[model samples]
Target: MEAKKAVRDQIISNHDIAEKFRLLADLLEIKGEASYKIAAYRKAADSIDHTPEPLSTLRQQGKLETIPGVGKAIAQKIEDLLDTGTFELLEEVTSEYPPTLRELLQVPDLGPKRVKLLWGELKVGSLDALELAIEDGRIYKVKGLGPKAIERIIEGLKSLKGRDIRIPIGKARELGKRIVQQLLEKTDKVEKIELAGSIRRFRETAGDIDIVAASEHPEDIIDTFCSLPMVQDVNMKGENRCRVMIEGGIQVDLICLPAQHWGTLLLHFTGSRDHNLHLRDLALERGAHMSEYGFKKNEQLITFSTEEEVYKFLGIQYVPPEMREDRGEIELSLIHQLPKVIRQKDIRGDLHMHSTWSDGKCSIRDMALAARSLGYEYICITDHSQSLGIARGLTPERIVEQRKEIESLNKELAPFKILQGIEMEVLSDGSMDLPEEVLRDLDLVIASVHSGLRQGREKVTSRALAAIRHPLVDILAHPTGRIIGSREGGDFDLETIFREAARTGTILEVDGDPNRLDLRDVNAQEAVDSGCLISISSDAHSIEGLYNMEYGVGTAARGWIRPQDVINTRPLDEMLKLLKRNRS
Candidate 1:
């Protein structure tokens, strides 16, 4: 366990070093440094970020330069970092402009150049200082900054202050998958490797990645894991446990146990913390002490090879990981009534997506073919409406043309249907972007707020209510207009909107874009409780984006959404019946 933890810490340290270099590069570029010089630091940071082998091991072996993009100078910097946890150049550069200045970049509209200007011209050294400058008219004096820019900056600062620090679950899952895949390929000693913890539970955001593996040769597995590409530092390398920080500053913990104890160990580690405690209390009542290795009952050790056996031994129905949040799941398990959460296979269609008609990269035919390939029965082409001019939102004439295109594709594809839809923007002051005539002609309509999202709570709520009340609107896409980790959702009473959606028969969308994943799990659950149907959509702009449905499914599972509660799970004929616009 100690060794495992050491490996984890080392990985984190590696990531920290790489981040410092990235920040240095950013600062240098802001200072008008030569492009090549800035590129060199960025390249080094990228190589270090993605390198398979630990930098320490490479440095000790005198092979640091063997890594792509790491020349002698960069190699030397790595050595310095390994020796003292930081390089002198970073210290020198950061002294001129405090490293904390980088936090300004967290503000939505504040880029490196603007941060640089604030730092250099106004001497704004921190977020508080920047706020002061903005309030005192100093920010307006800066070239290119106007009253509107100042207002946006104020909003951005507020968002930054309120933002949570954890990484989005999609990013955490991608990192975990990469690590698990590499571990499987690099080591034959491992029997099974699976992600555990909040990531395994499909939380909307995760603090780190936890993995459990069954292995006869634990040391070999640990060694292989610490050497995989993207392992920045190895903080621990214990006999049966390893912990490393991977690229992007996410911690990954690998705990290896004998194959017989895989189920017990996995359950113990894949925890919400509260859930595990409740389980432990229950175990005590059964005269057993449960732990990662096994259950202890009267000096006898009981271990299971499968999770079902483990759950059965505890006299409870199997609880899916996503429902292990201790929110009545324990009670449900006792009664054998755990909800059958929605799964990827249950999704029959993607109702909210875009194509080349608007901002999407793929053509309608290409998108249709991709959906067909994915075994989806149908897909909706929800191009942007004219209000979103930047996305090339469609004019009324264009909507007619696009509907004709959809009709043609439906004929060509036969049974694989293409549903015509529009992601019409909800304008401020409670109005729909396109006329009801245009919307009524479409197979589906997804109303969303694209601009003026920073409006007051009542205004935003009113805008949402107007869309929901529109008889032709089938769904609301990314209802909150939030980009995970970047911006906060518009201030609106979600429960009010959810209740209204239920009344109007308007479905809510759980956009599958990793960056969006709007209708976050908690809010989705609220919508579900309010009896609103949901549509798990990829919102795919490209063929590759179609795969985002998996993430959407994960989010739905987290929200305890079941197949019946999601309209997209219905077959084409059934779905179309629900989608029929109320012409009255």
Candidate 2:
């Protein structure tokens, strides 16, 4: 009875519920399910995911069906999942398509149809089998599996190799913050707490979480940390440090020190190893040795309460944590010439987002209200264009209607403008989806490659370059098309694309989606270095997603992008004048 009660009491978050639906949708698609059925499941999943309230609460209130895209049938499925952890259709579906096949979906460029083809034709049912097929060159014979596609699969598999060990930066930070919050709220004697290490540096992925704290009673804090509900097992405990395995097998180490040592401790732990080595060499040059406690100068100990003080003592400008990758930041700091990277507050608007008109969970007014709450001066409703029907892409007629709605919202929410825009698809032949006349009159046009991402490098490059050269197009969104751990970006000559964008005055995007920080840091830097203007945007699909701007800005900062480098940082009129169509 107690076990059953505990099971019933288990908290299943909205993300958990949504993931099941999404996985079911993918598996059903691989089973050759009807297009409309697959779309319904995916849509329901998106709605559930974006919902701010807990579905369990909604279910208790019998309001699950109230969610957009979730009808009576879907509501029952949610109830079944909540009650017993699985539903009949999910069980039946997994039987038809081996659950293992779902793993293949994680491989880049291998969507449902491609996975079905490989499974049916090559019997590539598992990652090992798929790898063997690739090794034996058997995948080459699969009708739709081209050489480029196989290369992407190879790269995707390589990325997944160690994925289970580390979490993405967004998830890691979220978890890190939660742990820190719990400690501060529940524990005693913790004077200062900060997340440190690679996570602090805003790396794309993190292995273990590092947290540093300052306290006079370090042992009390360490004990409380080890006993937290999230800590699965305490691996080691010392006077000043404790290492524990958290709920998901993620290792977290808490290093507690005297309050006076925070500056040096944070600097030592928030390191790239290479960065610390450089700092150590610099300290040696000054007749001192560095440690987490402090620098030692001629048998005297020096400590600081803040990072800025430590840098000041070293006679260098303080390097932001995101720039602490030892990528010549120290040298630049010595010269007092570090780039003033773009910050969250510097952004004036978000230009690329979706709405209910095109697979977004929120209405235009709801999305606009959410943006207004974030202090954004403006946002462009760049819904997917006509060719991408899966997203309910707007037809020319629908776009005309959308403009009417935008104009209404712009007036209602006076001063918070909504720019009517379209995320026009760059089709397989390098021709854009919308007619030129339709695209020309919009407030903004974002040309993106949504299909045929597996084309060879030259073809893909041409596709992208053609879009960049289009006079109506103002920005190239998520130029790489990579999904972090899930997929590798398209193979394109980014140098050529960047160069072309520079010449054409087309802006390149540093997308803020955690999963698709396309034009990843290195590429964003290269794009900027090539003299291309940048736009940092949260390709947010829901209001909660608007917060993803921080991730994008972090990526841009790592690339050394400054506010002046990002066009959206400018005021609305100046920003308009900078767009390709408006540029004199």
Candidate 3:
């Protein structure tokens, strides 16, 4: 009886509904269905995934079809999912094909057609079976499976292992904030709530989410948290603690305590292992012991109301969460010498962005307007150059046309300038894609190697160095060309690149796109320490993308990059003057 009740009450979220649609679409494709049918399901999945209001709420109001791309049929399916936790189309498709067959589609280069081919040819329906096929050399017998393709499949499998375990910082923060927002909005039980753990530390990726909440009634808060609509299952529940598996297969632990212990609880959970251990040693030296409740000294528990108070009690400076990585932060805090790392508010402009002139979704005017809305003083329009035709790279004539539009926009949006720039590609043989005259005429030129990313260390390093040495080049964007977990970054002699970049007065970019975040924290630290100027940019393709700058700022803070170390944080005139073209 209890098992049946549990099954009936299984939580269903928008993400779960969207996943069902996506899997159904993939199954249709693998089954050789009509292209339009597959496309409809895919479109519906995207729309459902992005819809702000819960589909269950929409169903209650009989307005699910109001969502874009959600037709009456899709709405009915969604309603059925909300009511019964399963829909007809998904069941029908899963019966025809082993549900695990869809998992193969996640491997790079193994699309629905390849998955179909492998399944039909080798009876490979799961990752385990695919591995066995590879081990027995049966995979090579499949048509169109070449040596290079097989190599990519192997690497993709390895990448998936880590990808499955760690969540990108951007995704983790979004999930964490959503949970916090929901908890605050839905119930009055929570007095204070904050994201803790690695998400708090602003690491590039997070293993899991940890949230600490303060409330006079701890049990009520924990119960409310475990019952959130996004929670898929309750892993464990205690009087003051609960662990839940959220919609996207990530574990979230919520710890509730009395308001008086908020500071100690947050400090205990927002740690880097070594950072906390160091604090414990410091406490012991002071004839005290520390725990989540407070410091125990002379058999008395001394608690703090705020983190500042806790730090003051310890006779040390309050360390920012991102700097609590035990990397000389404690020593620096003791001496009152901790660097004021760059913050999001310190940013004045974005030096890298795209517009419809290239493959960007927004127009130059729209992007400029969006940046201005964010209180940005200026932005540079750095669309792709001609050689990278895949992104609709602009020709020399197109560059001239774009400048006219930028000039006109600048007049309309006074005090909010738009600088003309190009993301000029570095050819395989260490040559500039656009001519010197065209590059020199622009307000800024960002050189990057997009095509020859896999051309080995020496050749790729030479291409990068040539671009950095170019007098017209002012910044290097996404220097290593890494796409986080999916692709490996360029194997370059970064120390040499940093030295030359500093000497040539070229700034290096820390791309703000969560997937990119190139010149990641460690690299940014080494570059700034080596005297290379760094610029944090969103590399945004749309107006909403401009907000990604916070992720870049987080990465910068993790690297201990001060405001003076980043060029975009400076005033418009100072920033332009520092560019290679304006420098004497």
Best by TM-score: 3
TM-scores for candidates 1 onward, in order: 0.80, 0.87, 0.88
Per-candidate count of clashing residue pairs (backbone under 3 Å):
32, 0, 0
Writing each residue's lDDT as its tens digit, candidate 2 over 198-309 gives 7888788898999999999998899889877677799999989999997668999999999999999999999889999999998999999999999999999999999999
- lDDT tens string, model 1, 1-584? 56545544554445566787898997787666787888789767866766767787887799999876679988898876766656787888888898778778778988877888888788897888888887787888888677787788888888777766687887788678877877887778888889899888877788888999998988888888888877889998898888899766778899998899988898988868899999999899999999998899999999999888988987899888888889998898898898899988898898988898997867999999989998899998999999898789999999988878888888999899998888998988778888888887888889998778878999898999999988888888899999888877799889899999999888898988888888988889999999899999998877777888988888888889999999889998888777638423
Pairs clashing in candidate 3? none
Kindly report which residue stretches of model 3 are placed more than 4 angstroms away from their true locations once superposed: 1-14, 17-51, 55-99, 105-113, 162-164
What Cα-based lDDT does every candidate model obtain? 0.85, 0.88, 0.88
Clashing pairs in 2: none
In candidate 1, stretches whose alpha carbon ends up further than 4 angstroms from where it belongs are: 1-103, 109-155, 158-162, 580-584
Worst 10-residue lDDT window for candidate 1 reads 4-13
